[model samples]
Target: MAAERVEKRGEEEAQTRLPDLSFVHDKLQKFQSKMVSDFEQRLSCMVEDVLQDLRQRELRAHEFPNFEKSDRKSTWHNRVTNQAPADVSDAPNGHANGTQPRPPLQSETSVRKQRRQLPEKVFVARESYLTALLQVEHMRTIYHIFYIILVMFLLNVICYDYFVDGRFDLGLGTFRGGLRRLHWVLGVWLLEHVFVLALYFAFRGWALVRHRLKPHSSLQRFWSHSCLILYISSQLVFCFVSTSLCLKFNLPFVSACVLLLESTRLLMKMHAFVRYNAERVLNGKAKKEDAQEEKEASGRPFVPPLSCYTYFLFAPTLIYRDSYPRTSHIRWKFALNRLLEVVAIAFLYAFIHERHIHEHFGQYGLEPMGPSQLILKLFGMMLPCAVIFLCGFYLILHSWLNFTSELLRFGDRMFYKDWWTSHTYDGYYRNWNVVVHDWLYEYVYKDMYTHVFRGSKVGASLAVFMISAVVHEQVLGFALQMFFPVMFFLFGVVGVALVFLMRSAPKVMGNIFLWFSLILGNATLISLYAMEHYALKNCSLSNRSWTDRLLPAVWRCYN
Candidate 1:
């Protein structure tokens, strides 16, 4: 009996160790059965990406057919969306058996590209045009544009301040003498308009590309937000630190520029509150609806938004007063907070004024500087003196830059209460506050995009962008403003927000239009603001009275 038990155990062990012929046969058969689809599906993604890189590089039509892609698909090709090639078009869905003839995949070295993923790999593009752009095989070439622009600005500033001084010489001569003055105006304009929003916009793009690459896992998003935070924070630290250092002591322009470029690591600390809020809003809505359905079976209340169109009646309530945290909800809090912020600001300013007012009487403020002088003063405040660089940094570290918060607050409310505020909705947070608006788009909008628009990534991507631009404009004003910033910011933000629009309804489609209005209105408003600031700043010289300054600022609307 012992020998028989040993023999049975040995036979069972042998059976377990042996490969299963039947299982292998089943797998091989299944693979062969789906071989066409597997081959075509992969080929579809590859071919689409290759052709897309071609079309983007503006390669002339090759052997590929001029098939009619959806309008949204064409737009996706134009816009900077991070969607898979197959997902962008219907080519894969229509793919049939061996009889079906599809576009041949190009093998150009420049045409190849690997999607932007964290675990990186070098791409071998098939085409030469893109090959030059991506010689090292990286993500999109837009970064090159930013790099070139930065270099040009610095060079122009350097040449103007040191060399040109006013010589009608050749090459960079014209730009040399005028550089300082131009820098005064341009710097003021940039500090006012571009600097604060630059990183936020860039992060919007980074987030989109990340969403495209990673279709699964929520935790990986931490890496995405981290990348954004790094990029943005780099800009702020580099600019502030460099300027703070340079103005105090004369550092070589080369050293300053190099330091600014390198040390300015990317850091985008965009808010996650928006995403969490949207998630809760959406999840809560669905769960409530589900519970309501169950309760209805037990005879409970049923509430609909009256009619599809009538939903607008509840729009304000839905966005502002819902249990959810919304822009409107935040704005009211911000407004009240800003009021206290103003009082604190005024107290601080007044304390400084009282001290300085005794030394220079009423001239303690920027009274010595005329309008242009005031700009120079503001410009000086924005940048740091090489000598006082550390002092100022330390001071700001301790005291919040003395008066900057108040100044920004004063300016913000002034602008908000001006003629433009009527053109927009009541609350600043709803969308006017670009900072928080970007936060909403990234966290809230992006979540919806990845989950809802699983199949048609590109269309959903562009729609959200377009919608954001259009709505922001209509609400902000189309007749007065240009739409690029609104477009740029909204495209970035809405592209962010609409990432969720896939599972969203046409009502939810309102995000698109809101973004549109934001794009048009804000772009125009800011453009008008900066141009007016530059054009009429001199007007203050002619008139110091309230009406003089106010009139000139208003007249800037025309030119």
Candidate 2:
């Protein structure tokens, strides 16, 4: 019996070591059956391992920042989403998705205190409308007409120079002079980029340090608030220091404009980064303490990669995200055409300035003018200003933005909507410059409504207008080295009033009214700014004082 049991165990071991091919008649068939069995077992194990890895990755992807509630798919393209419908548009109030509803008021007098989540900005592959439209024959004619106008302006310049000066001249001296100190502008921009890069690393380090601290402890809260104070102080210092340097070095108008504009851009980028991540950093403990919250926060990044932060600093949109929709390949031809358009439009501006603006207002403050002359000047400036308005729209919003987007291979092409079709100021404001509008709406308007004003819609709207007005005024005022608040009054007061008044206007009337207002407003703006610019140069200061800089000197010039 012992011998039989030992023999049985030895036979079991031998059978486990190798599969039997007893039915095969040839050596090749025996080898093939053995190989097939071994391959089947290995394949099954590999598939199981792959499926387990995929499950882990899926869990990581579901984790969202504290600010976002649901991860909806982009309206423009198909990437993975939370099974949201593709047909719906992004509505501000969150009604389109039917997921979030407006909260009820707390009491008869009190408003809702709960914060509303903003709709995520979607990115998809698309071409700018004008870029596509110009490809058609009818739309191409308008482009040709503009080209012809450019040629006519060039001819007029050459003819006038030949006749008056007895030599051909392009008269680009002013244009060239205005663009001086370009190298200084470039240097400043380089430094600004470097500073922002350092700022990102600083933020990343703080996040890591904070992550290790006891969640919701006094030390954690202290560091969080201290970081906030430091960030605000540093940004203010940077702004003031850069502007002061511009004044101290006496940078030209164009250089000052570039530097200041860039300073504002970086400031916005930094704020967006900080504000978007505020919840995650502050609520780190919630993930660990609560089981439900832990499921959502598990595998989510504590701090986003440096690469993502760096990309946000330069991306066309002010709003930041981990990733954006991207194109499969770059359209080199389209990029080249956009580049050419930018150059052509720049020359068009110079020509318009020389023939229309400079001829009428170049010597503005040097001579006395009657009220009739002033009215005539404003009207005459209207057509040229309209041209300028169109040129600027195409140059920056379409050409320049498209160029950068193409280079980045960014898929979102809806930078600006069909703002021209809008009948009301509200629609116009939202459609025109969709890039900047998104940032303001998300960070400024939404935050105020959710946290500060307690869902007071009117108060939130007013706050948005105030913030925009101030920023606009700051850019224009600082660049021009004056304290005139014409932009502030126009944007905050007059523009807001128009938005309300035009609400009831008829479609046909509204369209006409919108155009009329735009032309008139732009004309007044250009005329006043130009007059003041030349006035400061030509008019003598009685006593050099702050009042002289703050007050309009056009009156002095006329006196």
The most accurate candidate by TM-score is 2
Candidate 1: misplaced stretches above 4 Å? 1-168, 171-174, 177-445, 448-534, 541-559
The lDDT for every candidate, in the order shown, is: 0.35, 0.75
Candidate 2 local lDDT, 1-559, one digit each (tens): 9999999999898887555443334677879899999899788767875886587556434532211223422332222222221233333222232233334545633332122333445455555667655655666899999889778878887887789778865756655776778788788889888888888888877887777777789998898789889988999988887788677767777678888888998989988887776656665523254777568766343666788898788778887765666666778998998899898877777777777887778887777688998999999999889989888898888998899988887766768876897789988998888888888887898789889998798899899999899988888877888767888999999999998999876555787899999999999998888888787877775758866666687777766
Off by over 4 Å in 2: 1-117, 167-171, 285-301
What is the Cα-based TM-score of model 1?
0.22
Model 1 root mean square deviation, Cα atoms: 28.8
Determine the C-alpha RMSD for candidate 2 after optimal superposition of all C-alphas: 25.9
lDDT of 2 at 388: 91
